[model samples]
Every structure is written in C-alpha cells, then in structure tokens.
Target: MSARIQEPRSGGEPRRGETLIQQRNRKIILCAALDEFSAHGFHGASIANIARAAGLSKANLLYYFSRKEELYRALLTSLIDTWGVPLTSLDPDGDPREELLSYVRRKLQQTRTMPRESRLLANEILQGGPHLEGETLESLRRIVQSKTDLIRSWSAAGRIPHVDAPHLLISIWALTQNYADYDSQIRRLLGEEADISDTPQTFLETLYGSLLAS
Candidate 1:
C-alpha cells in the first residue's frame, strides 16, 4: 500500500497572522498545482514539481496540502467555485435568452483564458472523475439542477422553446468547452491563416440566440 501523507503541523487553530500566511500559501500552492496538474495530469504530477513551481520545498508544499489527492481535490474545487457563478447567477427575473447567452459568454471566456484549468477538469471527468464525485459533484449538480429548473419554468411560461433542460445545459457545456479541450486539433485545422479569438464568441452568441429565441 502507498504510505499515507502527513497533514500540516500548524494544527486546527492559527493566529491572525498565521491564518493570513496560511491563506496566502494555500493560494500559491493551488496556483502552482493548477499549472502542474494541467500540464502533467494527476498521476504524472508530483509534490516536488508543484513545490518547485510554487518556489517552496516539498515539505513546505505539504504544509498546505496533506497529500496529492488533497491537493488535486482543492484544484478541482477551485475550478468548480470559479465556474459555478455563471450557472448560479441565471436570474429567473431576467430574460431567458440574455441569461443563457450571458452564461455561454462566461463559459467561453474561461475556455479562452483559462483553457488549462478547463482541460484539467475535463481530463478528470474523462478518467471517471473519482476525486470530483463527492461534495464537489453534488454542489455542481445542485447548481445545474436549479438553473435547469429555471429554464423549465421559462419554457412553461412560453418564454423559451420547450426543450429538454438538462440536455440543453449539456449541449451548452459541450459547445463551449470543446474549444479548450480540443484546442490543439482546432488550431491545427485552422492553421495560422485565421484570427479565431473573437469568432467563437460571436458564433456561440448567434447560435444560442437563434436556438433560444422565443
């Protein structure tokens, strides 16, 4: 069996200054872990690599995260937290088309700017999302379900076409995330002959605008 990893020594309680430092350290470790995990994936990534990327010793890195699974879970949790907002912010009080388009824009923006993080999460899921299956997955399901409920309500009110809510959300996720997850293939097919940065955004907007138009 693999040896168990050690938790931080600072224990459950920390002083005000210590808490601040802990937060800062955890933030750095998380960022470094993002890069490492994104580049090398979970099994290929290591404490030494993360610590080096974060400019800390392996022991110091462990001070923030108890083990590799702990660190990986933190990274996935951060991705969920960062991307959860667009879904949660879908206002029932707002126009359905605008709300969904706004959500599409936010998701596409993450693909454009934070592609590594996007792929990292996608990779985890492709491998069955073991670490992402617990509370993190539960929280995501709740958010998606709540928004899907709003979409259903809108459809019932004759605001949007009566489409399958969960399937619609899945389609939106696939369309937006494909750019990040398949970026290499996409860029290769397009070659250097095209400027593609803003095209995806416009294309997505138009596509959803037509699909969700009442």
Candidate 2:
C-alpha cells in the first residue's frame, strides 16, 4: 500500500514545491493514471484502481493528487507539453517546404510513440473537453494561432501555394493523428499484423511538397 501516509500541503493541494522523492512518486502515479484513464476513461476509472496500478494505496495517491480530476488534469498537462513540442519547432525562418515536412515527420513519430496520449486527448475532445477549458484552452489557441500565422506568412511570401492556414494545420493533424486515434479500426481493416511505417510519411511529404513548392 506504499506506506499509506499523508503529507500536509496548503489547502490539501498537491505540493508545488516537491522534493526529489515527491517528484519521483508523482511521476509514478501519473504514469499509472495515464494507463488507467486511457483504458477506462474518467467516469469509468477510480483512484483506488490507479493506486493499485501504481503500487500505492488510495490514500497515498490522494496525498499527492487530492482528487481524481486533479490527477486527470495533471495527465492532460503532461500530454499537452509533449504534443506542443513538434508544433513549437516550426521555424518561420527556415525553408517552408523543409519546415512543414519536418513538422509532418515529427507529428507522425509522436503518433507511433505516444499513441496512448493521442487517444487520451481524442477521448477528451469526444467528451466535449470539460477538462480542457479556460487557461489550458486559451494557451492552446494562442500556440495554434501563432503557427497558423507563420504558415500564412509563408504563403504571402510565395513560399507555399495559397492554402487556408487553419485547415491545413487541421488536415495535418487529422492525417497524422489518425494512426494513433484509430489504430484499432486501421489494424482490423488492414490486418492484425499491419504496420504503417513510412507509407504515411512518404505520401504526406509528397502531398505537402507539391503544395509547398513555390
């Protein structure tokens, strides 16, 4: 039950200033929570189950997270940080063709490596994104708008063909993330052992290459 002890924090909140051990424990708890939530969803999951998966008691988990919602929010925050990496790497100063293609490659790589996180975000959006409101949503909007503006600038400079910046970004997301969000359907339709390797990468690069060529 992982010693089943409670640590005091301000207003029973998870500590903002965590020690090394606390950081390690928090990471363990979030990892376990991700698996549990991704499999069963928010309403279907329980703190007790996550605790068991993390080798901690329910109370021990609460000492770190306070509530299931908080834990879920933390998980989403971590996933957002990961998802932002590829988007944030888009360099307006770089060649438009290379930058956009690199973005496609990086996004596809995330789908392959972080399938669970991608599916988790998709599930949240399917549920109307109750947890993804307010500041988190605003932050996302700002980041996306910045990239879209960058894409528009590329078009204005005649670096790429005239394209709707927002929809182009949306299409890239839909195309790349389909592998993660619809893995089961894709696998069932293709084969049990179907491995989507460089096919999407090659096709997308070719498609966008033609679009981005000045």
Candidate 3:
C-alpha cells in the first residue's frame, strides 16, 4: 500500500468543487505561507503575516484557513505528500543497487529544487514536530518501517552488504537534506557567486554504490 498522505487540499490546491477565484486564492495563500513558514518557524509565523504576504486581508486568509495551526499543518501535509512520491517508488523487486541509487538521485533533485520545503520540514522536526502528531506521524512511521524492512530483505538475500537499515536511511536523509537546510553555510564556504556543481549526485551515488555492493 502507498504511504502517501491522502488529505484533501488544504494548503495546496483549492478544495474540490470550489470556484475558480477560490482556487486561485488558495494557491496564492499557500505560496505565501511557504515563504513565511520557511523564513520563520510555526511559532514565529502568524496568520496576519501570511495574509499580508498573500495580498489578502486577515479575514480573507482566515476564510480559507480558519487557524494558523490549521494552515501550517495543511502546508506540511502537502509537502510530505510531495516528498513521499519518490519514496513510494522504491521497488522491492527492482535490482537493490539500482533502486537505492535511483532513490538517492531523486532525493538530491528534491534537495536542489525544493529547498524551502526541505527547510520548512527541518524546522518542524527540530522543534519536535508539534504539528505532525496524529495521522501524519503515523503515516510517516509506516512508510519508514516499510522501506527499512525492504532493505533488510535485500541484505538477507545477499543483494546488498549487511547494513543497519534504519541508520542507512538516516544517513541518506542527512546527506541529501544538508545541501538545502545548510545551504547558507555551503554558499559561505563555496563562495556566493561560484558555480554550483553536480558533485552531490556523483558523490552520493558513488558512495552508496560502494556501501550497497554485495
């Protein structure tokens, strides 16, 4: 079963069966919320600020999202669903090495493309994920458990070297997410105007390739 979050549109697309204006406003609000939430975490972010950022009145924003917590959680749910897309595609029947490598590549792509979303999630987690408590947390755990079990099976079958499945997954997340979460640090070291390279993709694939070799 896919572990993707199946919540109705909240912070993302307009809810089903809404007028076009409502759909447009929801999209605008979500984009603005992403900016605010990324800049300031949940506690520091406010409905007023998000409303101003969205070019809507506080009442208008509230009409779409009744509460700040509601808006924040909706945004988070949408992000997790987006991130889960690549993860859900990790095929147990595929060659273990290739499957894992492809996962690494896709994660790196997300790191580069969805830096704000990545940082937003990082902030939530660093703060103990106060918003991601109920079903969201359960689904995340279920997905991680499923992937780890698959990794363990690969190890048992001699498809890959004996490895700590959970830590291996954690390492992949840390390696990929650092590129976005600490991008300022990376820029400071590499120089602001310097041309970025595809070293992350090359280095990660090569590293995991060796680590997963049977």
lDDT of each: 0.78, 0.80, 0.83
Point to the candidate with the largest lDDT: 3
- lDDT of candidate 2 vs native? 0.80
Tell me which residue pairs clash in candidate 1.
none
Q: How high is each candidate's TM-score? A: 0.86, 0.88, 0.91
- Candidate 3 residues lying further than 4 Å off, grouped into runs, are 1-13, 194-197
Error of 3 at 190 (Å): 1.8
Q: Model 1: per-residue lDDT, tens digit, 35-121?
A: 778777888898898898778899987876778988887677767766676688898899898999999998887677778788888
When 1 and 2 are scored with TM-score, the better candidate is: 2
In candidate 3, residue 13 scores what lDDT? 57
| Candidate 2 residue lDDT tens string, 100-129 | 899999999988887778888888888888
| Model 1 ranges off by over 4 Å | 1-23
Using lDDT as the yardstick, the better of models 1 and 2 is 2
Better of 2 and 3 by lDDT: 3
Q: How large an RMSD does model 1 have?
A: 6.0
